[model samples]
Target: MTTIARSEVLLCEARFYAFHGVMPQERKVGAEYTVSVTVGYDYAKAAESDEVDDTLNYAELYELVKHEMQQPSKLLEHVALRMGEAIFQKWSQAAYADIRVMKNNPPMGAACAGAGVNLHLVNDKTKKC
Candidate 1:
């Protein structure tokens, strides 16, 4: 059991290109990657302006994920989850966050292609406030 309101917060999503996978070949042979991130904030006014300072620049978020992906990792799921935590810890005014990273084509010891991991992450907001 849990309790949470229909809370609304600022959100943003961006795509990144990186090499992340469980297999060695997958890590060595890089491919285009995509990550989606959702941030929670109370930026209702900023959403309307569409200004750089007014709203969260998804470009920056992309860079953050891109950098995180570059670091060696055994599981994309871990990378995705860490990203959410990093964002909240690094960025100010960010109440919560979610991230999903996926490898476009994974080496399954076959000459076929398929979709990769689609993970979800949630960073907790400070309970104090």
Candidate 2:
């Protein structure tokens, strides 16, 4: 019998000021973005060892997201996708990644909170879309 070791690390609502939108004003003035990332990996070793090296580092993950955010994108979807991909690329041990990018106070004429996009990614190369 075999047991699957699964665990997820979540970074919630990390905020940043970035330029990512279709409107020119939005691109110039920029807007506040909130990014939430979930990383899945085997946690058995980390749990047993209780060492930082045995698990994913949250700071490193944040840096990766920050790097991606610095590069402007026209759409939240693109930013989310890129962040997911970058995380997976940087951390080969990550089995899955979920990224969400939210734009605060979207200028849609209506009194709206924000706009966002969520991206889910798996390590399987053949399964990517």
Highest lDDT against the true fold, candidate: 2
TM-scores, each model vs. reference = 0.67, 0.89
Evaluate model 2: give its lDDT. 0.85
Candidate 2, residue 128: lDDT? 31
**Stretches of model 2 off by over 4 angstroms after superposition:** 1-5, 125-129
Please give, for residues 1-129, the per-residue lDDT of candidate 2 as tens digits. 556545788899999999888988888999998899998877677778999888888998899999989998888888888888887787777888988888988888868777898888888743432
Worst 10 residues of 1 by lDDT: 4-13
Instruction: Please state every model's RMSD to the true fold in angstroms.
Output: 5.6, 2.7
The positional error of residue 73 in candidate 1, measured at the CA in angstroms, is 1.4
Query: Which RMSD does model 2 reach against the true structure?
Result: 2.7
